[model samples]
Target: MSHSFDPIDNQSNNEHFQEVLDKAFSNPSRRSILRGGLGLASMFALPMLPGCGGTSTASDAAVGAITELKFTTVAKSLADRIWVPAGYTVKILHATGDTLKTGVAAYSNAGTDDAESWANRVGDQHDGTEIFYIGSNGKSKGSYSYAAGDKAVLAVNNESSAEAHFFHPTGQTSGAAVGKKFDQFGQWTLGVRPAAEAIKEILMHGVTLVEVNLDASGKPTGYNATSALNRRITPETPMTVTGPAAELANLKAMMVTKFDPTGNTTRGTLNNCGTGITPWGTLITCEENWATYFTMPAGATVPTDTKLIASRTRYGVQTTATSATAATSRTQGWHTVTDADPTSRFARWNVSASGATAAADFRNEPQTFGYNVEIDPANVNSMPAKRTSMGRFAHEAAVCSIPVVGKPLAFYMGCDSRNEYIYKFVSTKTWDAADIGGGIAAGDKYLNEGKLYAAKFNDTGQGEWLELSINNALIKAAAFGFTSQAEVLVHTRIAADAAGATKMDRPEWGAVNHANGEVYFALTNNNASNRTPGKTDAANPRAYKDNDGIGRDGNPHGHIIRFKETNSMAEATTFAWDIFLFGAEEDAPAVNTNISGLTAANSFSSPDGLWFSKSTGICWIQTDDGAFTDETNCMLVAAVPGTVGDGGAFTVSNTMTVAGAPQTANQNTFVGKVLGESRLRRFLVGPKGAEVTGITETPDGKAIFVGIQHPAEEATAYNDVSKGVWPTNANNGVGGTYGLGGRARSATIIITKDDGGRIGL
Candidate 1:
């Protein structure tokens, strides 16, 4: 989730008559209206601008009133097809395992690719992505090569891999499980007996970068096989911590004495989900759902610190057997791979209470994987660093603003779990336009230090940004026993609870309106089981099950909440907020599953992917859902939204019982509901059992790119060829074969309007 404040001075623009005239005549529909306002003789005689033609002064004046262009549904094909307006076209720019080096073979459509090849090829499961234009000299930010008519280097995040089975020649589970015991050094002397499987797990957990060239028409022409930018960052890659953890006297000493390092550090980034691109052009990949990868051994003693436990649980690390048995344990089973050395980087995947004390064992594994991983994709030699200043949580995505010449840039993010919170970080350093091409140095200047704040939505149509600082009195008085500011920031949820922040539905991708500086967040979904008995509020009113089979209690299918900073500034603590869009079935009752007539085509469940086109000002929404998958796979929609409070108020009911008696007329009301064809439209759909995620656009607005993740994800029986033939056709056609013969692999698709006209016009 990124924070974006509008840079446009709408009020000032409205006062300028000439600028208004330019907008109105840009579209044919508005032009027709302007013509009807004048008689044929006057219409033919009016003065016209270089880009506009008109007849009368009155007709020319009519062109200045258009504020937003109506959104139209572009593509509607059942098969996987790229859709756009008449002037656009789409092409598959690259897919998982596409090689970025000369000696590496091109991606074969068949299933013959191996791990060594894949390590050098594009990584699997491409999720959040950002395009950084390399300039003519191929050295700075603004001079993107694409702008100079050369290959554009994109820093894409291969969030996770589903190629474990394919990575090992005999499969990941081919080794036999054995039991072993270790002596004094807190090491496992004996246990499982698999060597090969252990190596594969270490290689599977990081991000990959690939470089490709786009033709003059904006389609990807080919990849630069030998591009220095091509690199793979895996679990074994050494990374050092640079914040509070690195400065701690005890931690620093331990790092050198025990781990043979000068700073608090760990190896590799795991479970990277959504990402952000810095104004300086670096990739900020977020780690989500990282706790489940590790397992603490049986009959082990856990630490007594609640803060540590909360940190582990917040990220979903198994605290006990209950947490382990409750979910599908680690898929790779790294612990079972080696008996004598279970803590070998492979065995460390398990975050269980083993050995004895923290000093003797790797109990700190839970603390290693939750920060925002910053990598300079252009400089592959640089070690990826974890920016702990950005508080850790189930980070969904990070979006940033276009750094102004001298403004405090802000990053907006969402924690993607039930009842999580929304957060923002305002860089302490002011922006300098000259820093645009400053590379990682600029990132260090703007992103390294910032104040983080969590949102608290109140009933009065307003929200407060509670500071997540060590100096806060409430943080000092914590009953949870957090000792320092760093600990509070690391375990931010507990601090948020103390600050009385409002509990929200699962918050996902967020986008900033380039046109208006408003921030929008998608509250994906939350079940009734999460709501407290008497805690219903206006923003999250439904606490009982509704007709949608979800939201029975808390928010399900979720809604988008938008807020504007006071005076359209990012540094303000006070803001006005309202629900922007609600996910619902078209036929459901107005009270339960309706947001101003949102229908199936445009209505989607669990908003997971969200982005605003820098060029078109269109908001793209994508979903990762189980609640609404019965009708279709996840989808993408294009939206034009008004600021909060644009629409009038409406009342929603909240039923509850007090003293074991039913209380009637518990009505909660809120404003902000304006929906119609002009505001929202279905832009695209995904293949059967896939999620349409990670959307981005070229600077020129000529092309839009999106990721198709896990096509046919539900097909679990790998050996049953007929049940999982998706991606591949019925004729056993493999690799590179489009149209039914090849297995469906996760791919990145580029879309453009066929006419080469300005998009969203």
Candidate 2:
């Protein structure tokens, strides 16, 4: 089953060394800095773009094929308000700390908010989101309305939060204080944050399911928290650890906590980032960069067990003794609390194997996380299940296409790390219309028995899916031996290495074109050390200096990559691919940075979040940029993408050297069709220090829901709070120029056409 193309062999020694260094330095708090890096159920049917082919039964006339974007692309802005097309208007449907239940007091927008009420309010750091419609019976009825009529439930992911001010009586304290700062990526300076505050921080890291109904004017309003379906799933929420690895003996060796001695359960999902909605009515929230949350105790021994060492090493799990130069450290220093007495509930943060059995100590606690967790939004009481079959890594998005009549369902995912590979999981079961309303039962059938595949793109503008199964000879080789399918899923990157999967720029959100079954991924920016010229490939073909924010060399402005399966089949092993768009300034050199021919109105960098409208063929691109922020804040852009092979193939230069000579030129790298302002436009620009992420919409295409994450993230001091004030319309210190508000908090905004018409038509 080996292919002639070998991606791993092409990696230079420097590239390999730097990758290891990158992994060694990665931590939870620096997630965006590290690399700048769903269920089914009673199910929301896969939305079909207006002119796309699918099962979506919207009433709007099909445009057949989206040729060009109709509305003028919104220009990039630094204003605090949500910007959109001229006819569109924005509303704050719900924000962080907003009371989900009517009886709870409104959020003070200050650090004085009650910690006990967090369970009844919308969580902080909103990242991923999806809107589900509910029927009178309290079950998911699904929605096709562009204007989302009446009953709807919004599932929001509160990715991560710093305990400092979130739970304190006054915003002054950051709860945990580290006396030593690394001043570098992987150095662990120990600080002390309160255990109670740490607990509250964990409580806010999961998903929030809130009930929503339109206001009198037909605009979305605050959540109905008291509704039976409103629920907050935090890290403390007990969830089943199901899948091939669920019962592995090695898995049990790390669970020292009393909560689940059997190692069959884990307390809460961590770093729940991009999310996906199942057709059968469930929410799949991805766990990204979950490793940094664990702390290596001060005197803990490094793992002697080769299997354990390999597992920890590959997943970037730092141990106590791991140094800045070495590959491990107490990234969060959360384990510092357990230093004196490592037996309390919070001691679970320590992953050292101090006990003989997994239940006796918390060594294996970290293994339970880093998987996609499924929750039934319709049933608040339903237990969430971690679907491990999809493979473990820093999961970004788990996007699924519309289920075809007899074809197996497929889910697309990206691991958000520099030089990481793209992945896909195909169900063993064929699509069954009878399972339309199957709920969790349907999820169990499809997600539990899928074949995980890593992608390998050829220099000839072609790619193939390499299966990551234990049965593969290379995977079972003496060097990379896998004991079971669970191991293959657990150590996916190693399996991908054996499979020769292509290394990409940091892969983030993935969107499947419903109109043609094409898949698009945002390869977020990379630094020069990793993306040096000699290491560039057909997929990651750019290496240039950014002229925008904090200008640096390398592919500072990332690009969008798209591929169409051979014969347009989701399960196809072969495919044709191309660069959909390269993120850059409108004036950047046309040769590399501006490969997509971006114009002023639609130019962007660090393309992070991406989602395609099921009602319109519009592909919404969102950014989380440190590279382009000097010019403007993070923004969202909309585009109507063409299928793969829409553009000509070309060669690019590689000035990087190996021993003493410059590397050869890159070959036959395929770029997407050059798009103009008519097809790509800046749809919205967020406030300062904010990332525009988590995008979803009503089936009718009339409404768009966008998640605003980490607004004013630069405001480190509790007192001054002047770095960036957002989401406040008054007293913003900008003389009311910023319309959103002053005190920054992540929130979700609902966008609708002021004319009551379909959005972006």
Candidate 3:
């Protein structure tokens, strides 16, 4: 709900402040006197006078007048460094294993940190983050950057991890079977060891909250370790379901208590990727790739919940051990850790059915995850609630609008898998200002009482929103056997399939344009398996392969799609749509590679992060990919986007030009491309082996923050130095052979102009 903070609403007051300051500085005589006094007085003394050398009043005016802005220039280019503009500075405000509570030592970075310390430190793989300014009264200002009497609380998602060696002192290989031996460790095989390791690994994943402060320069300066807002939520934390599942008494009992309830609220939030800030001022972290953390033991009896099994498969959870790969087998084996007992935390991670009844087996564990987890970052004592009304799937990101007083609120989301559809949840209840700081109570009103719909992009450049209601004929008749609305929401993919909702190419993130009320999503590359020969549709046209070992029938690289509400109402069912840009090589065919005049510098693959600046109209694009790393790592681009259908119609066909051979029409045709610098331009590049994802900005437009994930992911053995030492080189400017120094880590960076210029202008 929207709460009014009249004093901070500076539109009227800032003008008055500017008027007086302008009058004092505009006088020519005052300027001369200030310059003269500068030579005699200290730097700080100049600002004490009416027209002295404080940040020029003109600077404040420029920031205030910034109604339109565009991202310009590469901020910083770290060879192994995250890029920002020259005027901006970056600090490691909080790091993985950095204690959030007192009595915990600093992170050793040498794989010696204890689990208790990690439980109190920031979690690993920080992804999506939102800055919530805490007002003096302990309420959230909901502002992006710092304000007077405001203490900032950052709610960040810890996407995923590969720092196995650092998390465990002995390393995963310590007791591992030697040289591919499977049965050397008694009755257990090498594969079985991974299952045990998986349990421990799952405990390490989740969301983290830390309190950060701004320096005199208005940049993130330091983190307060003992801030009441600080917390770490891992898989071990106890969490409860709030919807239909909550009605199941046994399930409710398990949900209400944390794994160690007497000790902590919930274990942690796992596979947390993209997130949303509720109208109530709480954080909604989506659990993605969660199914991958579990395993079904071999020869285990299957549960009767076929619908559940199908749901698991749709989210990429394997039902059979035969489907396991080396990576999948080496998983933390949470199922086998405490296989002797069915009720132990270790056994809960195991999704296999060892007994006939649900109460006696772990088959229900998989269902516990894959739902959205809501956290009250400002209240450490609050237990995270999983709002089932939002529906469940491989949730990539959840984004919401600033709740309008007495108006219905909406949340937009995307299921991050090839061929998945975009979704939205419109609250049934209207917003009330009193609910602003209501936290979970507010969440129960808006998030827990909404209708879910999936997007369908048609061939005519128009899209429709398909509802996933239980009463829908398709859902009722579907093989998944949906018995109720709650069941339909939990098994949303099956319901969507029955409803015939169109599938997309890995819709990673959905961003709502605050300026125009349009929605944009990143379709991060779909493979041939998802596209039939004659089934390629207009919105997802151009299925081809490049010599770069990607996109063989859509193997790699992706594009972004944009659409506007039919009537500017979020509840509208119909809207126009178009491809905003295509990810491709600069030298590739004009039809396939070029979209809106994107060049090599700006061209990138797998667009993952999409955010529109409230202060500036410019759109920021961040990438996550393995396709373009040979040239450079992930990058961020700035775009001046025109609404859907802004570009003229064109066709695209794919063909090889070996020996200058001619191609057929089926191979290529016309498509649209808006040619110009204003359309799209590469703004920044990230450190080696890193993905440029997650972006947010200060409300005043003075600062922008971007996340750099998985730097040096290519390194295999942490002990071996020569593999890949990325962030160390990028951040410290120190380069040497592998493992020479500098260990790679995920981090977030802030960028701004030195002259106090508005960002993205």
**Whose lDDT is greatest here?**
2
Error of 2 at 587 (Å): 1.3
The lDDT-based order of candidates, best leading, equals 2, 3, 1
lDDT of 2 by residue, 1-761 (tens): 00011122123122332232233223222111111000011112323342112245644234224556688667777655566677777777777777767678877765555666777777878888887766655556344333334577889888876423423444422224322222112344455545545555556678888887766554565556578778899887888766643434644444335557876677888888898877666678999877767766556755566776676766767644544353234354455453444335567777776777556666777778778898887777788987878888888989886568788888899988777778999988877756654667777888888789988765455678989988888778836567777778777778887776777777889987666567889888777666665555555666666655474667778888787788767688887766677788888776656777778888898888988776666788999887777777888887876655545433344444434555544422333456777778887888767888988776567777888887766655443346565666553222243222246767788888868776777
Query: Per-residue CA lDDT of candidate 3, range 403-516, in tens?
Result: 455656768888776556688888888767677667676676667666789876554446688899888897788777877786776677777777767666677888865544
Ranked candidates, highest TM-score first: 2, 3, 1
- CA RMSD (A), model 3: 13.7
Determine the backbone clash count of candidate 3. Answer: 46
Q: Estimate, for each residue in 367-473, the C-alpha lDDT of model 1 and write its tens digit.
A: 76677878776666777777767777777778775445577878888877656678888888886656655655666677667888988764445667889876778
Q: Which is better, 1 or 2, measured by lDDT?
A: 2
Write the number of the candidate with greater lDDT, choosing between 1 and 3.
3
Q: What's the CA error at residue 655 for candidate 2, in Å? A: 6.0
How well does candidate 3 score on lDDT at residue 563?
Answer: 74
lDDT of each: 0.57, 0.67, 0.59
**TM-scores of the candidates in the order shown:** 0.80, 0.86, 0.82
TM-score of 1: 0.80
